[model samples]
Target: MNAFLKFMKRNYKIVALVVLLAGALFGFTMIPGQKENDPDKDKLLIELLTYVIEKGHYNPAAIDDTFSKGVYKDYLENIDPSKRFFTQADINEFSKYETQLDDQINNRDLSFFYLTYGRLQQRIKEANSFYKDILAKPFDFKADESFNTDYEKMPFAKDDAELRDRWRKQLKLSVLSSVADKEKMQDAPAEDKLKDKEKGFSDEKALEAKPGADVNKTKANGEKKSFTELEKEARESTLKSLNDYFDFVGDLKQEEWFSIYMNAIAERFDPHTYYFAPDDKDKFDTSMRGSLEGIGARLQKKNDFVEISELIPGGPAWRGKELEQGDLIMKVAQGKDQPVDISGMRLDDVVKKIKGPKGTEVRLTVKKVDGSVKTIAITREVVEIEETYAKSSIVKKGGKTYGVIYLPKFYIDFENQDNRDAAKDVAAEVDHLKAQGVDGIVMDLRDNGGGSLKTVVDIAGLFIEKGPVVQVRSRAEDGKPSDKPEVLTDNDPKVHYDGPLVVLINNFSASASEIFAAAIQDYNRGLILGSKQSYGKGTVQNIIDLNRFVRGSTFGNLGALKTTTQKFYRINGGSTQREGVKSDIIMPDKYSYIEIGERDSDNALPWDKIAQAPYKPFKNNFAPAIANSKKRIAESAEFKLMDENAKFLSERKDDNNYSLNIDKFKADAAKIEVAAKKFKALGKYNSNLTFDALPYEKEKFKNDPALAEKKKDWYESLGKDAYVNEALNVLDDLQPKGGKTASTEAKKETRIKTR
Candidate 1:
């Protein structure tokens, strides 16, 4: 359900409150010495996780030999991403449990965990030793060799020499980018240097010191180091990286590994049925809380390093104006303390260090978007994740102003119904835009992974004089009162600002977003645009706190499991599961050709349909809007370039094997870089769209420079959005003759703002 991407925006809070409410009503005092860390909790956890999966999951697969083998396969791939850790002999030995994990779980045995953990320890030790040995010798950058970054193409090494060669080639590739960057830095002007000289010490010295090498050596001529020396530094960097990997691995406990094993088992059922450890559960809750007392940045792990994916608008990080997407977090420090190198740290562990009580300050050594590094300080505060809520602005085109509501998620506070929600926020924004005499409205739901189901129903009702919006089908179960498919209708006869409407969606729009989009499309209430389809995630999940199931025991903190409980269906008798909501006008984007969404997921629910909900479709459906958009989109050069870029990226992704030869590598990279230059013109493709913050936002922006900058960036991006530009064309075409509510047989076209 795009759960990974929507963690902070939606899902989390809904899940947490559901459990928190359940716990508060049912929980008893914990037994003395029986807290989550109790020794007996491991077996208890397995008992709980297994019970939940079997009893509560919508469709739990049999934990037979096939399932056990699947778990074994997933474990190997994730634990050793490169497939270099274990040999054929080791695999053969471990294959004994390939079909026994199911039985082991049933018996409450930790033998499999014990065996794998022990063997993995030996492998990591041996692999680190091999990496060190490989680093001891100089690598020939010009050597005619190649490595496959795609691990699926690789098998376990045949023997030790083959394993060492595998390690050697991979390590060489690891340092290639660093070496290239260093080369670029050396030739570039000193004024273009990314980092200041000696914030602490040189990288090479740190690497050598880790391996007991003295760092007192001086350059013989005190001249600039040659390419050869630079390559040496790159290789050393790779070694230090490997050392960090091993160091991080050394701290892995049995419980953590077992949780990974459990997750592997759960993932076999579905992608989103995750098993969170206690610490991870805590983090999940914090994310669901929405605003945390921290720097307020969304971070993601990119390979071995953590990179800032986004900054919560109006947060300390955004206000500080230092962090940006793609910036690598090199180190983290508190106050004047020595900064801890977090280059290879766990994402959650690193998060714990950065986030703190409100008012505390944390300093980050950030590698900026331009490869420049700087030390910046941010005072942690209660950072409101405003972007996760509904926000709107006005866009002017063709001498007419249109409303654009960017609803990031279908957010709602289940614990507190009175809390602000997407439905209410959007309703207010729509009224505001209507008051401004907007000719048309564009609702941007791109990257919206969805949130509250109740919010979806409410938001959907705003478009049409409402009937059924979505259908929910629940599998018949023991003790369940209803097993039939049910249609949820919006009883409120309200159509707020029903002027020409447009919805923008992409591969990331899923779950509740899909429901909303499907309803709008099904009802013919709006013109849908963007990618060929929205992310198909029609299933629903329920988070179960395992602690509740094991009452009267001291083994609390059994964590929780989110299981698929039901499937959502559209009112038009179609399932938005694997086959997502099709756009009225299929536009091309970078993700158009990517294998994402429910179809990419293993064991995702199949697309099926129940009886269509009876509802009236729009008579003046603005079917012409689709044709108009398609015409304009076909003529858009930026869209054509985007399709070409998608093709290039698809071909590039399939070409996984890469040359190790320096000359060949550079040639290939340059070829791709040059081809990428074609996309630079994308930003210049203006829609001639002028935007203004709503009156309320306009007033706030006067006192909030950061707010002004955020809106400014958003406005400029809209101008460059060829898809949105086409949507604007669609909007213009669909608007009524006098810029009133779009003409329909209902003749309901009044200066309507139905509440």
Candidate 2:
């Protein structure tokens, strides 16, 4: 409460008057124990959160004003990520309590929250009018204006007029895409709309078309959409989007906002330490359940649109092969019902619309990467965990077959030990591939975010004889490692699939993936190749149900806290906390130049080293293999194209200065389109690597032609993967014609370069 004291000293009279008023409003409670409409449960929750964060967090920050400042910043940023809502005056008014939040949190005071919430409500109402007023009049397309999307670089509006102007510019930028599409419509040749006028639009996205007016009127007639007509459509669309967004926002209760505030406080300890509300916990469980009756696309909110981040393999969407990743879902329909536009819908709400009972049909209108909209329908099924788990395929090149396995995540069923774990399942896959008589193994851990720590050791044991794989260090009362470092290892001496190995990783490979990759690299057990490094997530978390800590409370659903408890260190002293696992032979890809690792995260723990864990290093023949692979990557056209793609994307990402003027916007859009085409060639790269499903899968698919087609497409994509082809070439270089392990070779010490 040093900040409180300092403020009081500077303006004692003002502070005392404000305190008296705040006290009067807060049920005039002298003890700060109770409030109007706020139950004791919430107070208990606050106390519990503070206590758990302080005692349970691996390295808790001091709960002072400095910490309070961090919470203040986090809370404001969470609420205003784009700096589009609050103005300078609003920020100034809220800044008064910037330092006093620590005292308030400790005092169990929520007056500051009420104050900010009330102001935000007022500001939102103000913004609603601002956009409506701007959209009411015609926007001058010929006006020379530019919008800067680097929100960090933009200042808050100085006044209401400036705020309205800011809204006008933003709204113009938002409609640029629709305006450009309208222009394209103006340029297109007339279509035979009479032949197919609304013929196939029965299951299309719901549109607010005028009664008896042809929805495809533009396509039917040679006449183009007038500028005024485009303007009306764009403005109405924006208004609807804003209204829907506000409607969604209106559904959230004060408890949710308080949860955000509390989370902001908790995150000062670390990024991973999070408070999961009851609903959030349920959603987490659903996601972790691995299989659900859905279309099976991972959706992420990108502004107003819900973009497909991933298509779960073997799911309905993947089987259809029509819906790809990076597609933006605009609308969702169920059983031929009038489609509901899902843009501006909450992600959870959108997911609910897409998922249904197994065998139900769902239609989606998605905007593809090429800026074309298409409708895709799929019969939903229960996507199994097996699709996400270890699956091996044979890749043949130069008359040699190599085993390739892709581990999506180190998955584990927390509620059931009988459920398949990554380590066990992967080891089983290894035995199966060995049975196929594969010469070498290429384990793909790209995009694997990791799972159970016990599983990490188990999986590590499959490649090594017996040694410490990782060291766990915890925070103690003192400023040093309090607990003695526990080395997690496998005592099992049997090594499964001890052949020429190449572990494929990317920037997205993290946590348990990093642990396994680091172990392989540390022991020189295999050649690590992909992005420069893996996702450096070396910390561990334990979910603590808050209900277990409290008793005899009438309160329901106390929820849980996923708190960071420890950090994992590689055998040779380096913690993969931030630096991640380095690849022996780096290959360029899309995320090569992106800040996607744990190091980019706010409040992330710093990288450090502990005493080395004693272990016997394995001998590997990756030196010449890495050299040869590097030479191939340097010479290959696909690799050069990929490098260029990475640079182009990085440049685009860095250039956030967007033009609001039509000509400039069109010019930038054209440049982006051309650049996007160049990267498209990377997807078409074929290494002539042939892949075959396992015998069991092959036999099973024989009875199901649909499933067989899905498998065929997946294997063919593996054939097109240039990275996988290079990985196989590296394996060939490592294990000559005999195709055997070099484990019998003399052990040589190799120090990995630290970033």
Q: Find the candidate with the highest TM-score and give its number.
A: 2
Residues 383-404, model 2: lDDT tens digits: 8645777888997777777999
What's the true lDDT of residue 324 in model 2? 68
Question: After superposition, which runs of candidate 1 have C-alpha atoms over 4 Å from their true positions?
Answer: 1-41, 189-224, 287-347, 353-384, 415-418, 479-483, 551-556, 702-706, 738-740, 743-755
Q: Which candidate leads the pack in lDDT? A: 2
Worst 10 residues of 1 by lDDT: 205-214
Candidate lDDT values, in order: 0.70, 0.71
Write candidate 1's Cα lDDT for 1-755 as tens digits: 32222323333444444455455443554446854334357766776677666656666778888888888888777666567788877788888999998898788887777777788888888887778888887778778888776666778888778888887787776556445545545554555443322122221111111211111122467455677776677666556655665787788776776777777777888876878777667675665343346887777554335777556655777655556545677667675443555743566877887888888767776654332345666788886566457888898788888988988778888789898888999999999998999888899988677887778888998888858888776544452313466677787886776678889998768889999999988877887888889878888887777766545766546777877766788998888999898898889986666676688766676787777888877767566777777777678777889888777666655565667788887677677668777876765677676777889888988899876887787777677677777778888888776545663433353224222
